[model samples]
Target: MYDEIFETVVQITHHDYAGCIDKKGWDHPAYFREQIATRQLNDQSFEALMQDYLRDYQELHMGFRRLEQESQRDVGFTVRRYEDSLYVTSSQQEKRIQVGDRIVALDGETIEQAAKRHARELKASHHEREDWSGVLLDTSEVEVIASSGGGRTLALQAFTKLPHTPSYKIESVEDTLILTMTDFWNHDAITELIRHNEGRFQNAKKLIIDVRTNKGGSDLAYSELLPYLFKGSHVDLRDFGDKAYTLCTERNVDLRVELMDQVLQTIEDEKTRHQIDVMVRELKKNRGNGFVELDLSEIEDNMSFDTKQGPEEVVVLSDVFCGSSGDSFVETVKHSDKVTVIGRPTLGMNDYANVAMMTMEEKFQFWYPTSKSSAVDEGNGMGGVGIQPDVYIPWTPEHLDKDVDLERSMEVLENFTHKGSNI
Candidate 1:
């Protein structure tokens, strides 16, 4: 049993480490087997072994961190990076924490002080700080300075302060429709957002999508929005090595393609069905080779605008906090003339996607990015290098008093009107 477990772990790691693994680091399957051949298989020992393996692939969602003894409580809010500080934007109602609160300290140490102290353990990016804030919230109480110039303490609890509503918000800003999506985890929410805002989206001359703090979730959620945005035929590509697998079930190697099986079965039009059939067949033709082309125009789903008429001018707000599926969304749309990305560079975490979850025993589980993606830029593979914005606007602390990024976006749109995008 021990050898079997060790072999399985090695097999999964070798095939699913997102990027290539260094043999000198821990790539030797035989060496790993020998190292743990004598240890008794328990939660503690297995977790310790897993930790050593995780240190090498520190990319976002590259590995799962499951502490057998640590409490899983969280503060009711999530935060994002602005300048060099972390600020709360959404929270659960049970906690006193509110949106626009800046996290100053955790466990009694100032954030800057903590970052410096833990520098060796953390990555050299603002996204690391944002993630570390969430990690801290999992275990300790935090100190925050609210936008109203007051201070308070927030502690972790079973419930979070973030509202359990739709992940997106649609509102009018002059002639533009401002759509702020906090995440893409809820497919139902995405559908509701599109259905609810179909009329409003058509009336607006332009649209602004704010995904600054979105860390990502399901691709199915954001892909539902692509049909409305892209005008012409486009192809998106993904790779899953020679083979792909999800820990959840024994489906085909590619889960994204597998999701289409249900949709294909429901289509009644033979012509539409044939077009989709070709796309799906092409997507799955060479599953083992790792690269597959997806035709955007072929996919027929009900999650789009009836007119198929998108905004004349589009703006996307991004930051280093936009990671995972958020990275995928930005990378996919960056090339279109209909959209312009603004603000800081997004968090690069989508190069390796299609996370396969695996549970070890009953206490530990592992989530690995089994599929490699070339959607944003072919061969570039957005691992550490994320999507860059067309218009660069750095966030300043004073912007907490004034919405600088939004104002800049509005100005850019107005300039496009008068200057015809020359400015």
Candidate 2:
């Protein structure tokens, strides 16, 4: 398992975006290989060890697609890491533990200590990680200290499947419309939502898009919303004037073929199928080429869309949880003169994108980006730092009960809500 993973990281993975790979001088992999060899680990334990090694990259672009067993599961609550302390952002499972509560300890160890083993170890502007306090924790109890004072031992419920959250939600506060998109995964669903509420969107003076928890899917998922949010006629995917540099290896080309097949099987949309067909053909043409530069500056996709009238002004609510296509949406949308990005920076998975998968011996499957961004060499890349918001509203304990991000948006909109009408 170690050997296979090491080869993938060292040989297969393009060492452009993940600065850690070069920073370490590739010594950690060999060290981890030796360390794992000392232990007699089963499949679950093996992947856990590999995951720990993978964490060194600090890139969400790479991960395990399929596992031998359910090696990682979460305690169905949400926590946000502030400095060294872990705060409960949402307490869905433990009613006793409020949103402002601080997680003192998990099992017996301090959150700082437990997070290394239980949660993902990542360093970013806001390092939010999976609350891997075990599937049910060591014991179904967590030591949560109240924000005001005092502490209580609250119970937790772990989940193999996370609690269901809707793809998109639309709300109106007078002329202002709040579109809360949980994720861009539901391409058709998001498209439908936009089409369904066309009148409400067009009539709005201000649009507040909440993508704080969106993990991202196909960039095309939020395509329909682009026209509404965009204030002008044109917006490009290469908002920074960088071409999408896709690495065309045999593996990557094969993965594109696999993706096309999957799309053909599941997707009924003629346009989507045609897009996939085009992508596969392009990849096939560039097979064995080092890095093929795909010019997205003039691409006619929804990403590089021509705008239509809807909301006059737009405000996007983003957090560290948002990444990949979600990050892409924010990056592209921010280019518009009428858009203001609020909340926190994204998870920073845009350094490398268009992720593809590779299975080794049918034991484990590795997921990695098939494309590299031109921003990597340019040095202005949204890799580690992510897309910084214009009006930075630092997330706080008050954010739990009150929609601090939304409130800030409302406040901003109030100052200049009905100044003009054109989108």
Candidate 3:
């Protein structure tokens, strides 16, 4: 009877995998083969099976190769400094070249066409290697806008301050200090700024940490900064979800036991108390037996700020690029009373990812999740709906060019500050 059902289901479903229809038939491959053979498979069915198998095999192979490339790719970029003249280096290769002498073009056009033409001829002749070959051209418009040394310097400075540019100057308004971090991981300069202001937090009437352009980085660094803002509060900084198993810990057990004790003592109804007690005992048994300890003690100690403060006011600035550790930071901050998040919605990834190491013969590589992460809720996978802000502020091209978001944040802070004033 089971064999007939299995064959019927397979035929209807168009599945081609081989398996026994019953436990007794597992050892008899001939019987199993005969059962499958009873139903004659057509060309279309055979082709479908072959295509499905090939597709799955190819996908598995491609997945491994992608992981390999990600682990091996160079994660570094060139850094150029402008001294008396611009100097650029391909940091990985340690190749250095002077800009003015080599790069004779602004855009596609030449700064000195005759010099560039002659340089091209020399380059073609192989007098110098291509690694050191091309002239270093200024990508900015300042080169043309200011022909002289002083004018060029001023224009370059202004260009650096341009809103759309990669870097910007941080400014303070009233009690609010506006800092926009556009890159992943805090650099030495940013670290120093945080350190310098650590002691001054008490003086701040309100604090705003802006990361609208923050791409993301080390989760440890991002989350470690939270305690400082809170001062002191026994806040749960992390939560984990397991679908198949209930996670347990001494701390979780104690928490459950304490809650149960309270419920048993507080509820006057005998039947309800008895029912609650039984439920608690069953839950405790299941969790106590299965609980796995997660090492969050490290994070607890690493938090620089005291946890005594119940709540403080903080506003997190976010955008689509805020991900990974950035997502963790935003979620962690949302728990505090003092923290009121403002800006556009986040990318809504709340869980962490693991970077796995792989090897292909002699070459070693690693694979990381391009879009794989679990949230506190196991079902809330990566790319889930992101966190929405209390106040929604959209980005516009004009705002990008003029720092409109920063201005809006200031307005919010000003209104908040003035609302408390008796005047």
Q: Which prediction has the highest lDDT against the true structure?
A: 2
TM-score ranking from best to worst? 2, 1, 3
- In candidate 1 the C-alpha lDDT for residue 35 amounts to 59
TM-score for all models, in order of appearance: 0.68, 0.85, 0.44
lDDT of 3 by residue, 44-156 (tens): 34322322322221111111222232322221222222221222232332222221222223334443442344343222211111112223212332132211222221111
Better of 1 and 2 by TM-score: 2
Give all candidates' CA lDDT scores.
Answer: 0.62, 0.70, 0.41
If both were scored by lDDT, which would come out higher, candidate 2 or candidate 3?
2
For residues 1-423, could you state the per-residue lDDT of candidate 2 as single tens digits?
566665665565444223333335533677777767788876667766666776666667877634534544566566776656568776665566667778777667775676555444534434443433332344567787888899877777654535457668898887788888878776667778888998888788788999888888887677777777765567665455456777777777887688768757866656666666777778788887857775332235755767777877888988878888888888878877788898888777887788777677677877777776777777877876778888877766677678888888887777665555322
Q: Name model 3 segments beyond 4 Å from true.
A: 1-171, 183-192, 231-293, 303-312, 350-352, 357-365, 369-382, 420-423
Each model's Cα RMSD: 6.4, 3.9, 19.1
The list of candidate 1 runs beyond 4 A from truth reads 1-7, 21-52, 65-71, 75-113, 116-121, 127-130, 134-166, 185-199, 215-308, 374-379
By TM-score, how accurate is candidate 3?
Answer: 0.44
Which one wins on TM-score? 2
